[model samples]
Target: MTTPAVLLLIPASSYRTHDFLEAAHALDLEVQVGTDQSQVLAEVVPDRTLVLDFFEAEIALAAIAELHSRHPLSVVLGVDDESVELAAQANQRLRIPHNSPTSVSLTRDKFWMRQCLAKAGLASPGFQRFSVASDPETLRDSIRYPCVLKPTFLAASQGVIRADAPGEFNTAFRSLQELLADPELQKRGGERAKWVLVEDYLPGLEVSLEGVLTDGCLQTLALFDKPDPLTGPTFAETLYVAPSRLPETVQQCVRKAVEQTAQALGLTTGPVHAEARVHQGKVWMLECAARTIGGLCSRMLAFSGGMSLEALILRHALGRDIQTAQTISNACGALMLPVPKDGTLHTIAGWDTVREISGVEAAVQSLPNGTAVRTLPHDARYLGFVLVREKTPAAVETTLREAWTQLQVEID
Candidate 1:
């Protein structure tokens, strides 16, 4: 039998590469990591890591095809949003099971996901796609208030704003229009980059789900409850506690809506990360991505036999017969420490001390001190993530909060 070899499409900035590499090592698979920038070690070990153009799929596929001809790959996995689309195309080219490129495209565009959900009678809000060049004065009177304006392609809540009145809406529109006009964004040259989606704001607490799809069948892995209120002019998501405090009935509704949403998007296989809002016992789908949870947040989950979330995803990508991925009994959670203010971070105190706090598994600082950073509606990266596990959801939340209070940061 040939040793299983896999190709992992990883964005250069993704924090998940280490975890995924460790998982691959644990599974004893021959792993090749492909990123946008050239890796130093790839010069020595050609199969170790190579440069693949994520923005240019044709060039990437051509390179992957040539590599595949030399060394047959068993599966292709993607770690972040940008890589997932490439992964789908590579899987299709390599004759490995994967989600349709069309479905993955729908997931990337926020408005497209809304249209699919609404057409399927799933929980979706009213939405419209508008070009940034269009004048907002013409549509202001006609458009509804209490709606959200967001970039179709941007994630991590960047350029997502809620406006409760016409004044607020106009303000948000102008702000977002300026953001969209940035040459860096315009250079991307896609409908998603040029346009923004305005949609009715779903009221209530927001939550997120992580699951995997097998031949179109959805099996939920974790349901995270966002304790912080997401209703905002700028959403700064900070924490996620799992084994949600919501009733089982409510969780079931969320699961059903997510499953239907995935089916509606025509996603057949691989990991699914979904966000939704719950109001008066009804669930409203926010957005779904054909990838696992982003950032180091996946560290919050613990599966049977201490399997990391990355391991589970990699195994599923390899077509292992994993019917169930039951997590351990303990409740788990993570805090994505949000950058407090707009300035250069000079120092972060108590981070080491917080790491020693019981139940705090990892306290990592993503950006180096003295690095300039901005708050939401502008920046997408988190300061870092602190993960924990406890006996109950409440305990998990408490541990996270207690650990959070210890961190004192200075910026100027």
Candidate 2:
């Protein structure tokens, strides 16, 4: 039997791509990565690699065409929002199985996502977009207090801000508009200067669901608990505990919501990352990412529930029998290293002290001691994360707090 050749849509350095390779190996599939750098592509090539210039749409299309000429490509997958669209376009061009371009667009644009979810009768916050030309005071009057504002395309809470009143809204909106109007940012978005989302704040606990979508069929892999209440003014996530402790009924509701979303959006394949807020005994779907969770949070799914969410995504994208093969074991949790304030990295103390804490298995600090850290005006400050493990949830939480308190991460 010939091994299936999988074409990945990202550079190899990305954590997502690395996890994909691991999952592909487990499924017995040979993988080939597609990237823009010819040099990097050369290093990974002839072992079934292809060079794709994702930055330039025309170039990506041409490159995929050439690869199609060489041999049949079965599965195409990518991680970032841009890469997701490229993957969809490549699949469509080749008449292969993948997500529809429309679905990819809907997932990429936050404004459109909210519209779609609301139209479908799914619970989503009321949101509107703003441009630099819009009068800040007038806009503020129309918006609810404690609303969210950020760019439409960007993620990771970059430039996201919260305004709790008319005065705060004016100040925040003016500043955000300035950022959007920056020459550098304008160039990145092809001179499209639009302020981000203005969302009616949802009061509740936020959680993210990691799952796989096969032929528009959504499979719930793991439900993650956001250790911090993400009631947005600054909606940056902190920690995640896997195998959510929510009641069975709520879990079922979340699963059904995600599945319905995938179907409504026509996401036929690949991984789906959905965020929702539980408010007053009801679940409201936030925007969904057509990829895996970001940053160190991916590790949460791994250690918390013994489920490798990213790996499962890779296997599904590589056209393997994921349903019959994947497995999970123990509960795990992860916390992201947060940026407290804009300052030079000074020193992190008590590293040795935390090592002495019980149930503290590993601590990975991504921020270096001299690196610059900055925080949003409304967001809570976070230094780094400490991972703890135990047999029971109570034990896990106890150990986590102990390690967190013991670690002295001082920034000056």
Candidate 3:
């Protein structure tokens, strides 16, 4: 019998690559990274690394098919949103346990996801899609106030803006259009980058869910209560503290909505990361992805017997029984440090002091000193992340906030 080998789809610029690789190493699984970045080593190490056009499914499929024949991949794991659609397609063709291409594609498009949710009788916001090239002046009259205009395919809230009035709507729309016209974005998303989705903003407390599906059944692993109100002019998520402080009933409702959402999208297997808002006791589904939480956020989820979220995901994909995988006792949180401005990251200070804070587990500066950083509505990369654990959820959030204050990041 062959040892289970994974084709890990990691984008060239992804922040979570090292964590995923570390998890794979811990499990002693064979990994062949599939990335869009050109590899000079490809000729010498064809089996270890493969280049892929993540946006082009057919081309990616052809490349993956040839690789699979020689090294039989048991799991096609995607590390971020950019690679999910192709991962679904590759896994389908490889006869591996995976979500359908159609399902994964739906999760990628904001408009398609809203349509699916509304069709399934779930709470959904009124939305409309417009071409980025369209006249925002003419379309501004039809848009509802306090609506969000976002690039349909972009994640981590890039190119997402909130418009409250006619002037704000026009300004926000035009600004986002210019951003969507970026050549790099055009190459990555093509026409998916050429349109915008304007949806009536759902005002409420936001939450995130991390879970995995088994044969179409949803097994929720964590429900993170986002202490910060995401009433966004730009929604850069700040903190996610799990074992939620929400009422047990509200937590259950969030879980149920996510379960219904996974079923509605036809996602039967693999990790599912979902976002939602709770307003007046009604759970409104904001977004759901056919992958685990992004960035260092997954570190907050640790299971019994020293199992990480990535390990649980791998075990499930390998067809191993994970009934013993229960979350460790204690509340944990992650503070995703968003880039403050556009400049060279000159100096990052106080990391050592942050580590000394109570309940602080890890404080990472993912970017090097000279790397450029930009804020949201244009750039999607986070500056770094701070992870914490405590005896209670409130304490976790408190520790995260204090740890954040001690750090002094200067982008010159």
Candidate 4:
């Protein structure tokens, strides 16, 4: 059989995509990169490399269709959430294998996700959607105090805020509305002025599960324990430790919840990122996406044990064999570059000192110096990340704390 060429839709500079492409070449798969245009045939070029951006739906669909109509390959795949929908649309039109379109919509829409979970007997936080928050009185009655308000569609913790009381809710609502109306945000998606989700703030130990699903059956891959205290108004994820220290039963319960959610969402193929709260021995599903974890910050499975989640998902989406691709290993954790204050990043101190910590395997500063950063509801900036491999969880925690202390972020 001839080798199948794969097209990856991502920004050209994507470090994550580069990692996957390297792995694919090692497996003897050819790659092609382009904007989603239907005329770009992969089958014609047995060996090619292309990375396309499919953030815009119409353009992406046209490109994929153009390619499929000509190349007619064994597989076509996309990793971005925006492109996931496009892929599903193309799959139905092209008769290619992919996650169902219905599932994509449900998972991408945080509002719909809550409903789906509640209907399936899975625990979901109480939520309310606002096309207009005209009355503070009625809105206050609907949501529990100390709630979270955020855009229903955007990620990277953009537009997410906590409202501790009625007064805070009104202020946050207007502030978010204005932010959405800003020139840049308006260009991104704010012009539509769509609905926002206000939900009961969940206070518990937060953990994230990364999994792979094939033909709708889930194989639990990795569990990450959130090292930062997330019980608050601003849920900033600072640290992630894989192979969670949770007991066996709790782990099993979390896994079961994730699998059931996958089935409900019809996430049959590809990687799924699920966030849940382990509160009082009960696992509550908070959010899930049909894409791999973002920011390349949490490398629990791939960078952790050498099992490339991105590669496995791409191969699986294209209908390739992936059983041999996944492998688990020692506990892996990532600490997002700590945000010391809201200001421009002048310099980071104690880089050499953190390197001296025993478990730290890799440390890199992700942000450029002189970049102005601020606190969210607007800012989600980190200086760098520290990836560590340690013999025990305690050792890992101690090492992270020691490293965290030694490092100084000068935000002025």
Candidate 5:
């Protein structure tokens, strides 16, 4: 029997590449990585890494085609948001099982995503798109108070802001304009950089759904509860605890909403990560992406006997049988260590203390000393992540919070 070879599309900066490679090693599968950085090519998978620009899909697909001609790939997977569309396009070209490129593209654009959900009779907030060139004051009359302003293509709350009134909206609009002016962000968003999405704010508990879609059916892996209310002028995710404490009925509603949203968006395969708000027994779909949870958050999940989420995703991509998809009985959670302020990070204290906390699993720092870091609306990367496993969800949340309070970040 020939071993299945898989091609993975990964951003050079993404933290997920290592986890995916670890899973592939365990599965004994031959792996090749496609990235944009030539220097990283030798660092990751050595001779197996192919240099491909994620932003230029046409050129990326052409390079992938040439690579595939030499080594046929049984699976082509995107490791993060930046690579999803490219992976879909490559899959379509190779006739591999994957979500349609059109579907993936729709998910990337917030404006189109809301339009499709609303058209399909799903629960979606009323939203409008504005151009960066439009005068912020002129657009005021069209927007309702207490709404969110977001860049159409940026994710992880990089350009997400909330406005309680027209004045705040004007400020947020201008801030978004400045954010869009960022050369790196502009390069990532392409033409979508010109548009901003404003949506009526949905009030309630915010939760995230992690699942996989196969043959148009959603197999829910886990539902995470955001214990800290996401009510925001600026949204910064802090804690996520799973084996959600919500009532079973509410959980069912969230599941149905996600399933419907995925169907509406025409996502039929691979992992799906979705966010929604539950308000007074009603579910409002916020957004759904054709990829797994972002950052180190996936560390919170583990199958029956400690199988990582990455392993499960790889197993599904290779058409292997999954005996069970249930996470371990013990509750697990992760905290995205918040950046105290925008400045150069001088040092981080309490790593040793936090690691020694009961139930603490790992404490990781993503940035190094003297590295400049900014808070949300301009920066999306977290300082680091803290993982914990406890007997109950509440305990897990408490442990994560307690550990977080002990740490101190010095940004000069």
Candidate 6:
């Protein structure tokens, strides 16, 4: 039997590469990493890595075709937001099973996403898109109070700000304009940087839905209750506890809303991470992505037989039969260790103490000592994640909060 081979379109900064590679190993699949970073090719075994410009779709497709000629690819997958559209395009060109590039594009642009949902009669917030070049004062009268300003493309809450009045809205608009002008954001966002999305803020408790859409049907894997309120001048998500405490009826509503939203967007296959708010018995779809949960948050999920979330995704991609996708019966959660302030990270104290707390699974830091970091509305990266597992959702949430209070981050 010929060994199955897969191509992974990953960015240099992706946190999921190691997990994906490990899953590939478990499945006995030959893995080739396609990246824009030439240095990354050297870090991997020479034959296993393909250097390609992810920003240029045509060039990237040509590179993938060339790689496929040498070793046939059974699946093409994207590890992060930056690569999703590229992967979708590659899959279409290769005649592989995947969602359409157009569908993925709708999800990437915040304005378009809202438009689609609203047209479908789904519960979507009032939204408008404005070019950064436009005069803020001209748009001021149309602005609604208690709204959010967001970069059309950037995720992880970067350049997302809440404005309560005209003064705050103007400040936030200009702040986003400056943020989008940065070379890094411009390179990542391209034309998306030229526009910003303003949407009415939905007041409610937030929850996340992790699921997969196969044959245009949504099968929910987990519903995470964000115990920490996401009310934001800047939304920095903290603890997320799985097996949400919401009543069964509300869970059903969330599931139905996500299913309808995916259908509306024309997303058919692969993993999806969606966020929504529930207030007064109404579910307002915030945003949905045609990718797995970001960062190391997937570590909080596992299947009935101990299959990792990455493994299930790989299995589905490979067309292998997955008997079940149920999350482990034990309650689990994670804390995105908050960045206290903007500055150079001098040190993190009490990691050992935090880890020693009962039910605290692991506390892993992403940034190195002395590296510069910033809080939300200006930055998106979390300092680290603390994962926990307990018998009940409340216990897991409590453990995460207790562990968080024990640690102190000092910045210079």
Residue 21 lDDT in candidate 6: 85
Candidate 4 lDDT over 1-412, as tens digits, reads 7777666664432335555666567657766654333234344333453334455666666767787666765555556554566667767777777778899878877888888888888887788888743555557666788898887766657678889988888877876776666665454343234677898887788888887788887777778888788765666778788778988899999999899988887778888889999876788888788877766654435533354666666666667676665445466777776565678889888888888788788777778889888766666555688877776666676777778888878878
Question: Which is the better candidate, 1 or 6, if ranked by TM-score?
Answer: 6
Question: For residues 62-124, could you state the per-residue lDDT of candidate 2 as single tens digits?
Answer: 887787677667777777655788888888888877888899878877777877887888777
Q: Candidate 2, clashing residue pairs?
A: 150-196, 303-332, 304-331, 304-332
What is residue 169's positional error in candidate 1, in angstroms? 1.9
Q: What's the residue-level lDDT of 299 in candidate 5?
A: 81
TM-score of each: 0.96, 0.86, 0.96, 0.87, 0.98, 0.98
Off by over 4 Å in 2: 11-13, 26-28, 36-53, 182-193, 302-307, 324-327, 349-361, 377-386, 410-412
Candidate 3: tens digits of C-alpha lDDT, residues 1-412: 5678998898877777767877787888988889887564355335588888897788889999999898888889887998998889899898886899899999998888988999999987889999889988899898888899998888888988899998999999898878977898887777788888999988988899998899888898999988987887898898999888888999989999999999999999989999999997799898999988988888777898888888888888889888768899589999988888899999889999999998988999878889977788888878789999999998998999999898888988
Candidate 6 stretches with Cα past 4 Å from truth are: 44-46
lDDT of each: 0.87, 0.70, 0.87, 0.71, 0.90, 0.89
What's model 1's TM-score? 0.96
CA RMSD for every model?
Answer: 1.7, 3.5, 1.9, 4.0, 1.0, 1.1
lDDT of 2: 0.70
Kindly indicate the candidate among 1 and 4 with the higher TM-score.
1
Error of 5 at 145 (Å): 0.7
Cα error of candidate 6 at position 39, Å = 2.1
The sequence of per-residue lDDT tens digits that candidate 1 reaches over residues 211-278 is 99998888999999999888898998998999899989999999998888999999988899999999
Q: On residues 1-412, what C-alpha lDDT tens digit does candidate 6 reach at each position?
A: 9999989888888888778888888888888988878686556646688887778889889989988888899989998999999999999999998999999999999999999999999998899999998778788788988999999998888888999988888889998888988998888888998998999988998999999888888889989999888888999888899889999999999999999999999999899999999997999999899999998999888887778888899899888766566887589999998788999999888889988999887888878899898888888888888989899999998899898888799999
> Regarding lDDT, does 3 or 6 come out ahead?
6
